[model samples]
Target: MSQATKRKHVVKEALGDFVTPTEKQQIVKVTGSRGNNLHEAVTARGVTFLVSMPPKFRKNLWIKRGDYVIVDPIDEGEKVKAEISFILYKDNIQYLQKQQLWPEGFTVEPDKEPEKAEETEKDEDFSGSDDDESDLFVNTNRCNYQYSESGEEDSQEEAS
Candidate 1:
């Protein structure tokens, strides 16, 4: 087929519904690019290795650091041990998490709620202050001028 048709097909397949990894495939977090369509990634078990991006996904899909992808391991390569099969999006991650298929190391903690509550309390406490010193540094550089019909300045006022 044409190049455009191939790209469209690859993109559609990459973005299609989430599919669970097979026996030989596993999820990995991309660490950095290794050049020549090769990427360095870490698996859920903390093993680091290189993965090759397929030609179809080379330009159609862009993978970056911290992005998760499912990789199929290769038995022949020494340095490049895997090939990326699918790139995970937010929805796909959530779906995998819901199905209990997501790795525990990749789960996000919900510890920010208490921090947000503390910040709101601090803001409320500061809002109750009536100190006039807070306005000591008010901007006084504004100038408003009113012009008459002749275009001459009639009056000038300094905005507070």
Candidate 2:
């Protein structure tokens, strides 16, 4: 009888599972792609930056706008760009959420649409009567917010 030896295979672990992200890496939301291996993304802290895709990433990962990704900054200099390190997936997001490592304001709430509608309904159903509605509108126009140009004032007024 001939016996065959079993081979042990090395398995790679997913991000946030067996291994945690490095300090240099930051989670970012892909706002849009600028084409030519470049993309516009925003960090969890609301910092906007442009990220570049290297040949390896471009070939390996199928990235697109509105995808969450982990990036490592090129350097601590004037350049406001990073290298795409990991493309976030559903399982990765769930792992982050479970570990409480997910960034604030970036939580993927399952029932966001229903929650938003409930919040709107709650806002509309204020206990105070219509007579007290005017009191809720606080006007701070007297504050020192001078508009340099008349056009600026018009735009600001229109925005308010």
Candidate 3:
């Protein structure tokens, strides 16, 4: 099978326990590229955020400007930033929209500045410590995608 086909199959098998987004995780639209795995995005409420792509997504998913993505904010009192958790594929976005589960009022107006209050709100939404941030989602990068026909046990175990 091709790499993309394998990835899709694995993603389907692994997403059995897909967790829905909480209030903290907001859907944002990529406004511009910031280079080095970072992109400028605007939240549904028009909050401009600096979104960074985690190495896992950078390697596995293709993200581009104007694409809608899920972002989890990482605020440390100095500057506001977010890590891209899920890249919204067209089908995923369509499903969310069809179910009316999409974040309300999502827009990507250009050259918009995030207000101070909005920035503070975003900061407050990120109450967890830095360590907790990494635990929010399962890291699929460590999964073994290759299948063995013999059904033999391997030295390493995949996370279920």
Best candidate, TM-score-wise?
Answer: 1
How many pairs in model 1 have backbone atoms within 3 A of each other, for residues 3 or more apart or on separate chains, i.e. clashes? 0
Per-residue lDDT of candidate 1, residues 1-160 (tens digit): 9889999898887788788988889999999998999999998778999999988797889999989999999999999999998999988888898999998777753246578899999997897676657656655696746555752333333332
Q: What's the lDDT for candidate 1?
A: 0.86
What are the models' TM-scores?
0.68, 0.55, 0.53
How does model 3 fare in lDDT?
0.70
Worst 10 residues of 1 by lDDT: 151-160
Instruction: Report the Cα lDDT for residue 64, model 1.
Output: 95
Q: What is each predicted model's overall lDDT from 0 to 1?
A: 0.86, 0.70, 0.70
The weakest ten consecutive residues by lDDT in model 2 span 2-11
Off by over 4 Å in 1: 109-160
Give the distance in Å from residue 142's predicted Cα in candidate 3 to where it truly belongs. Answer: 50
Pairs of residues clashing in candidate 1: none
Which model, 1 or 2, shows the larger lDDT?
A: 1
